[model samples]
Target: MTAQDHHSTDLQRNLTNRHLQLIAIGGAIGTGLFMGSGKTISLAGPSILIIYMIIGTMVFFLMRALGEMLLSNLNYKSFVDMAYDLLGPGVGFYVGWTYWLGWVFVGMADLTAVVSYLTFWLPAGASFSPIDQALISAGCVIFLLLLNLLTVKLFGEVEFWFAIIKIVAIIALIIAGAYMVATHYTSPGGSVASISNIWSHGGMFPNGVNGFLAGFQIAIFAFIGVELVGTTAAETKDPTKNLPKAVNSIPVRVILFYVLSLVVVMSVTPWTEVKADRSPFVELFLMAGIPTAAVIMNLVVLSSVMSSMNSGIFSTSRMMFGLSRDAQAPKMMSFLTKSGVPANGLLFSCACIMGGSLLQYFVPNTIEAFTLAGTLCTILFISVWIIILLCYIRYRKSRPELHTASSFKMPGGVFMSYVVIIFFVFTIGILSLEDDTRRSLVVSPIWLLVLAIGYFGFYKPRIKNQNTPTKKF
Candidate 1:
């Protein structure tokens, strides 16, 4: 079959309002919040709450700009397409591949998180060897791969339920925490739970400016998938209505899921005492005298990691499919299964994700591996977000008519786009304040260099030859 014939089958619009809404919520509530918040609390004290809000506010504005651009043209599948149409093919190629790699890193980090949570279920003296952890990570990847191969609707249904579980768990924790504070319940450590606990230890900024900056590194990772809904635009049933609804709800989800949940946890456990090596969610329930808290919270966090990983697989495959159609990737990646799923791209992404299991043998320490993956994903994601903003700026200048006609306009328009871009630049600067994140920053440019080499040396030349006129003999 010709390349055009191979990609003739288009992705279906099977995702509904409910699916899109929950997917957005699920994306916003990443595993980082559940697993990494403990360390953030420890580093920044109660001020981590403010950090989340600041990040969330900036992200909401970013999403608004993204939503406006996506709505301006229903033909655009994802921000990659928007980048292609507004910026150019070269920029689109870079964004598509970089976004794919970002999700791959996120998948690795999620797998590491799953193994860490599973260890909670083991006996005090028992632990998973490197082989055992690798096997578990492989099994999880295979299971998610099989599920995504079914249909787009199934992916949506799975995310809907996954998001519901996360929402319910956080709500229960918040309610239980409020009751504890009201009743002044005393923990095993003799620390009394009270509203004043948020600031009593050493005031809100107990760890000082450096500590506050340290919190941004992990806290930024927690918000990595917030833009995932933009990827569903092609498969969404009604782009104009559903896309805006999903984007509009981001602020609410951030406040409830990130800010409020952490406030309750710090109030109950005190930020100074929150363990950097463990999940504060599990610890909060354990301190509440819930006998099976570890088991239950472990299960909840395991599901959370799986949810994010599922998202990673779905997004990477879709991105690959898009890139292949644009002739920026291998043609085989664009092939669709009978169910309208990008089967080739899906399998390829899963294969890459399975490689993450090997980190257990090489790194040994799960937290260290997780941190490295998270830092890399954060840097890549920040780059993608910056590109999206740049696309919006280009769109405004080139096609002012579209901006004028946009029903869901970005709040500040071009000015906000520049502001958000500067904020991302500042966040990258914040990553340099720490040793762990700084390493990723140093290694990130190498990926871009490789992309530059691929584009100029290979894809660009091939496209040029294909476009040049041939002489008839």
Candidate 2:
């Protein structure tokens, strides 16, 4: 028996250590890292390795802060809900809806990418067209959403495998790269480019300090969904126990899956050969003389997208469900079907995702929509992180008595939260340095502004006692 057994929260604890672990892992690995890593390498050159490590470490601390606050009070289900309780209903409304929009945009971009990857298996002439692909991708989106709406276990199982597939693939790539590196062989030949591919190009900071700094703009996107684990605490069977294990392992996974993988990639192929708009995973496989590298990588990436879409549905519906129980959102979204599922909320998000099908179908450029969607992801992610920071700061002031009761405390306390907020602000400022990313920088704030308006316009203040007794999270 564990201490969590004797001390359970009000929200129904339905997830296990395994469920929380996979949820965290699934959030950590994304289609972007699989696809956009090549672009990252192109932008920062070899210094991308250092950039990932530093960012991963900082994010680890951020999650730590979140974990402490979440476990600080059992009343907290989703982070936004917690924000509302600790701060006010306004923060919850704004953060919750913004977070939902973030995932919606992320799903749209990922669904489109899935279809684009599916193109590798289709005829070249037919594959290049965006509209046809959107139709099929939309179908895939429906299939995954059904899985989410049907069963919580189904969503968990699917995400488990989705993460495992990405994990296994990254692991395999690392091994293959190690083999090439040991043999002193690679596609592009140069002493510095060979073994020294990581730093020899321009002494690690090839493009200078600013180029490495610029990597954070996109790097933040890869870490966008990492907070999904925090949202899942409501569903975890032993959130107090399992959540800690899952949260603690984030650092290890980030290092093994991201940092180590990038080292092998640049070591085996050299950053010089990596293209601006391509995936390093595909490039590495192709360089290894694997004939179907394109198709195989596509399948893996498609699977990653599907995993995220499924998760997006689950997370948004749960958030809506939490809000509804508190009377912040529409009652329909809160109503659960016989199986205890938020049927209306799930359908609502799916309906929004279906709108993406229209987006991909009618939008003149698939790439532009994808880029805009990516920018939206960065914005929503940063906003949620910021909200968590403010919530923690308030938690310390309002509930100093309960802080000692928490088993897993966010180290460094308010100071850490303040530091992370500044780090995020700096990241946001750097986003404008590039013209392509500048639009996203400008657009993301507008999205948050819209969320702020919705909170004040539509919802009433959350009553303090509204969530007194609730089992569903």
TM-score, every prediction:
0.97, 0.90
**Candidate 2, poorest ten consecutive residues by summed lDDT:** 2-11
- lDDT per residue as tens, model 2, 1-473: 74323432233455667777887888888866875677678778877877788778778888988888878775677788677777766777788887888888888877666665665566645544656766776787788767876666667777888888888887877776787788876453342224677877677888887788778767767777788988888778867787788889988988898889889878877787886555677767666566575467667777887877778888878877776766767766776654557777888888887777776777635545666677767877787888888888888898888677877888788898898889888887888877778888776667757766666555543333353442332
Off by over 4 Å in 1: 1-8, 468-473
lDDT for 301 in candidate 2 is 75
lDDT at 110, model 2: 76
As a TM-score, model 1 comes out at 0.97
Q: Identify the leading candidate in terms of lDDT.
A: 1
Give candidate 2 regions above 4 Å deviation: 1-12, 122-127, 186-193, 292-294, 362-367, 461-473
